[model samples]
Target chain A: MIPVLRAAVNTLVHVPDLVRYGSKPFREGSRPGSFLADLKARLRTFEDAAAYPPHQAFIGNLRPESLADIPSPWYGHPLPGASHQGPFGEILGQGPFYSMLEKADQFGLVSLDAGWTPPANGASAAAKGLMSAGARRGTEKEIRRRIGSGEALALEHEGALIGCIRRDHEEDESLAARVLLENLAAKASGAHALRLLLEKARLPAEEVDYILSCSEEAIGDRYNRGGGNLAKAIGEMAGCPNAAGTDIKAFCAAPVYALVHAAALVQAGVVRNAVVVGGGSLAKLGMKSHRHIEKRMPVLEDVLGGVAFWVGPDDGESPRLNLEMAGRHPSGRPSTPQGMMEALVCEPLARAGRKLREIDKYAVELHNPEVTLPAGAGDVPLTNYRTLAALAVIRGEIGREEIPAFIRDHGMPGFAPTQGHIPAGVPYLGHALAAMRAGTMKSAMVVAKGSLFLGRMTQQADGASIVVES
Target chain B: MDLDNQATIKQLVDAHGAENLVVVLGMSGEGVRIAAETLTTGDPSWAGPLAGVSLGLPVYHILEERVRTRLPAEIYAEKVQLMEMVLDVAQIEDALAGLRKTQAKRS
Candidate 1:
């Protein structure tokens, strides 16, 4: 059964504006040995990131808020423009995200009112049902602490404390408010993307049978650290009023894995449509910026990237996910780089009776090179493409002399950010669909890999792939 | 799965004889202490396969002596002690090599 690409949406949040206030180090009593502390030091060393050319260019690739309008860069150069807004979603500034958090949080709801305030701003109930009860006025001391400590972004009406987030949790180490705040921002963005996708596909939210959150944030208190139903929560928030939800985790490969699972479900006739959604990670906010700053480059790791896509029954008009051709990095496979590509790329194509050259495009880790190169990781996509070409020659599919030309034909530059789980190769689906629908391309291969050792589970690498055909 | 040290110990003693070779699982606190005592030096560095066993799926093979194996609770206190026991994976491998050599010689 053909797995249809019904809809796709990508969203990003520019966190530089919100970093000081929302990020951990700038918080009142920030802890040591945290990512935030490292980030804080990095920020102090590199005052501004917007001033860098590569940073601006990085922003240029993200102009179309809608993945539909965005040109898939795998064909040629990336889409042009520095604008961060699109019809489906935009790179949200922190102020609105904080308001979104207030709206999403029931315990510490924020209320902003324009009542008698000049150019009004305050955290007021963005949604009434979630914050049905009128917000209690915060004490001057409490308001001062929230703003001063960077625990909450202050809501001011003519410089008056109109509203702020409540410190509902007792411990600083495990603040439910911050976790919920970050999660709600994702939910709001995902909800927005899902709405746009439903509209794009002309399908109602209720029609979606399942929702899978492939995001990497673990939201829970100390007692139930990783206990989660974030899938259900994100879906419910996205207005999937009747869908069941669950989270899929394999680190960077989650989104694609979710797509594979959705295809299987649709093919099995268990569900007509499923949405795989992932929100960006706040923890990964300034993760690699230390290297970026030290090298005198823009901290291109500024945006919180997110995407949601629909896996539905095939219609002749859409590109189909070749589920049977999907690859799995099985147990006992060697964890070497050569072993990895053999497991994820070559072996899968062999099983599907296809050749490596048959794939017009390969979307591996499309991390924007400007971000990685400065940090000394090199161009990730180019590396993968070169490896693939080398492997093709070794496998006797092509001669060693064809390696360079093979790379030129198959590889597209990587345009994704360092959002740990966001760029594990689904970004190309939008472009692949457009190209296939336009009859410009025949097939695109999406490859994703994950490090299983981070969990202390195993040292072996993990990978899975799915081919989409026109 | 819970580790049954008593059965494993009994099996090891039956196969290689107590003086020749001893097996320690480090399942319980006592088991870990006894295993550490047996080593008398060095540390139970859980570098490779042993690390997988501690935090991930357990790998088991039926020895010349048959004994069922069980793992400890996911977050038991004894786990750290067990992981820290003196049975370094390489050393354990050497013991297996010794057994292989012994079998070849006998043959």
Candidate 2:
């Protein structure tokens, strides 16, 4: 038998207010007359915690498996019974999130005491559960002066003033306040997700042996532009005293790559329990606001998504990851859709002597259609499924007519936010684990693809896939 | 959006004449409309050789039945079928049709 491991726990965090500071729109929208300038008004169009269905789903308040039965357009149907807290994690608002920024700040950069009063609501009190013990306190006078001098940006929640994030350096554009805030926000959200994994999985922080940060954040100053050690930083913030780790970058596909890496480490006995975590990307927020605003829909990309998964030796009860059957897109292979499907889906199954229909579900890029369609980016996960089905048709595994039914039975409506790596492939792990544990499903495969051209170094596309079996 | 693309299309139209030319676009979403309008009513952005040079050409998206029906069924299935399944065919076709109707009215 191949060395098998289990995904013990996972969590996703939704931080809406961080959009203004970390998103491309707010950064580029500052230019007068830019088309993105309209994003400021569009930011005001974000749905609150209770009213947003996607946010509800992200925090585990609603089961992702329930979306198919809700309606064709899931966003239009609000879950009135949704709450801020969920079995997995919570959807934090700007008020408490500002406090997170202050607490997450390792440097004396973030200050919440200035004009920041805790909201008289239960959400704030609940968010307090996520704060780290190493919080740095700052004076309001420093934040106010920085904002007055254009050195810092004010944090706002529900149109009210809160705290602010300040720049580390005086002159380096790379160390600008907004850029640092994006890094800190990633740290804050990643730390929150790790904490949730420890709490929800009932695993103590000290038990974690290692971590793999797959977030798209490029944390570095001008000297080493893209160099980083976010994994260690997140571990520190989450109180993983014994855990040491590093980042694994492959653009959006990094999460699944990290997943396989962690599983391999555990199987090889290099480490006991390895955690794969990715924080949200701030730059991706409001990426398609122009289309959303044109369609008169809410700015759905407002949320910063973070996800963490704990991988450990199979305990016989947890769903087992088939490490030997993992698929990878080789550099020598063609990058066409068909070619990619062969490498990432077909070849692995062929080697494992499994049929395409054996897999219960396929999770690819799970970007919500509500956020992508208006922006002209088609339903991402649906496209991946169709491509897989089309390949099956060519292989005589299924007839052309069976494509529709195959897609419906084996794929799902994407519920994860368009936060790059967050939706790449791992978001569905929680649901898959649940279904497998309940014996409702047997196995699921996660496929993650990345556009290597985004880095300007290569034109090749990258992809990786892994299967989990009950 | 490229000046070279506009120049190439202008040369092709001038050599073959606009009456014999049909621009088949393989674009998706909002880009389908702009690409079709550029071929029919000239470049909408007014920054290329096609600017104000109304070719009045009939444009069809690759996902449209008009184009798909003309291709060998097997070839279409092998090459374009997967893309057609993934793309928003209805939206792309509607955008092309809307531009074609506008061009018809102008002529």
Candidate 3:
């Protein structure tokens, strides 16, 4: 019999940093009166003004209790731990081989192996010269200190050590997405790592009944017209002849959503075995690292994107997909964006009849704090999770008094500067599965949210939650 | 000029009084109605006059159908353009003068 979800693993590699050696170089011709410059200036003003003393002054200017009432998961949690020094070198030293083995052993990942291509010449030169030079010379100490103190930055996985690729530098979104996916596919050589994991589990390629890929991309696309096409590219490379990829566009919640979909397919007798995989993209990494790069932040380049998995049987031992509930709300609603998120995410989970306190761990929006904080939003995923928890209490799923303790017990500060897909949803699956298997927890939930406004047409916000049971 | 929906090409030419009138035909819709009125009335404001007439089906039918299918209640106007074809630029200028005469009479 095939095991349900035998194992899951996540690996975050550090990328090299970009080095800028001039007075903050604004885009040429983007001087006063230019729309681009004006927008940048406005954003800079808001970011700077937010950091002023007398937090109450800014707070007073807004509606009373506006900031206070908004619940956040990281609200009183200690700042996240600092990155281990020698970022990329430290990651290389740790190696995917060792980390995967250790994690697999802990999670009962039956057959497992890991590998990565070394940084390319350009990447190595930039890493050594730009990244190390900037750090040693203290050129961006304030930014680095913030990063050291957990400020988020954009990150992209180029050829080697994940680095901060500037979003503004990209001329075309489609081309940028294609390059990012191609770079990731080239590095892993597609299907080799998957095959190794399958072999360790004693499963053959053809026996693999279905494949659920969770990298971030729009569904039903023809070419590079939509989001990145990582699934189609990897599926072709893996040669799973029966493979048909479905996009789980739920941002970070993707991996878990993929896991849930695979489990459901297996339970329905559709496929005997399935593989859930996602590769990191440079664009997502770059967006997260942008703030740090602009300020010459320390550890500005350690965000690396990596692929991971959960391979198991249609029916066997391990956590099973018990999708107790799922929810979504369209963007046309006149309600506030926060209200939209609650209706789509928090309400559905509550209706599933699971108390917030009953859930041993709630994994939602695990975006790297360092990557998002410098932009002034704080950890998005953590904030969403906390809000859900608070809503649960308000709804009587848990006592209002227990909300604080529940959040404190169940939350994680941040994971890595991986893209929305990396830390947002799937990172905790491995740990959650392990805890379930060990009977430490009966169930866990993974939540992911995304903005559809990026398309410029849809004001819609969407998210998904998956329940896994041991 | 109230041009009937089923008006013929000859009738349109006789009413407009152009020696070699161009009759651009299209499926019955906003474009067709506008073209018929402009041909009958010979008003430059409503529709430009034609020298050597041409008839073609409506270009906006597909777009109209699509919009109708998706948002039936939404009101949308069809964009249409008419041009006169003459033997030369000089004849084109003469057509414009004839068009002005008809327009002036209507005003």
Residue range with the least summed lDDT across 10 consecutive positions in model 3 chain A: A129-138
- DockQ of structure 1: 0.02
CAPRI tier of model 1: incorrect
Pairs with backbone N, CA or C atoms under 3 Å apart (clashes), candidate 1: A65-A86, A111-A123, A111-A124, A112-A122, A112-A123, A112-A124, B1-B71, B2-B70
In terms of lDDT, the poorest run of 10 residues in model 1 chain A is: A120-129
lDDT of 3 by residue, A1-470 (tens): 33356655443333232111111222222355423232223221111222211111111122111333333322222223322211111122112321222222211211111122323222222112211111111123333343343222222222122222111123554333233332442223223334433443455556666666666644223354544445555555554566666555555556666776776676666767777776544444344234554554432323344444554554455776655555455555533434644655566666876556676677777665555666555556556555665566545676656756666666655544445565655556665665666778776667666655555766655666666667
DockQ of 2: 0.45
Give the runs in model 2 whose Cα sits over 4 Å from its true position.
A1-16, A33-47, A71-76, A120-139, B1-24, B43-60, B63-78, B84-105
Ranked candidates (lDDT, high to low): 2, 1, 3
lDDT of 1: 0.60
What would the per-residue lDDT of candidate 2 be over residues A159-241, giving only the tens digit for each residue?
55556777888887778888888888888788877877787787888999999999888889989876888999999888899
Q: In candidate 2, residue A3 scores what lDDT?
A: 33
- The CA lDDT at B37 in model 1 is 27
Better of 1 and 3 by lDDT: 1
TM-score of chain A of each: 0.80, 0.93, 0.61
Of candidate 1 chain B, the 10-residue stretch with the lowest lDDT total is B55-64
Ranking by DockQ: 2, 1, 3
- Score residue B56 of candidate 3 by CA lDDT: 28
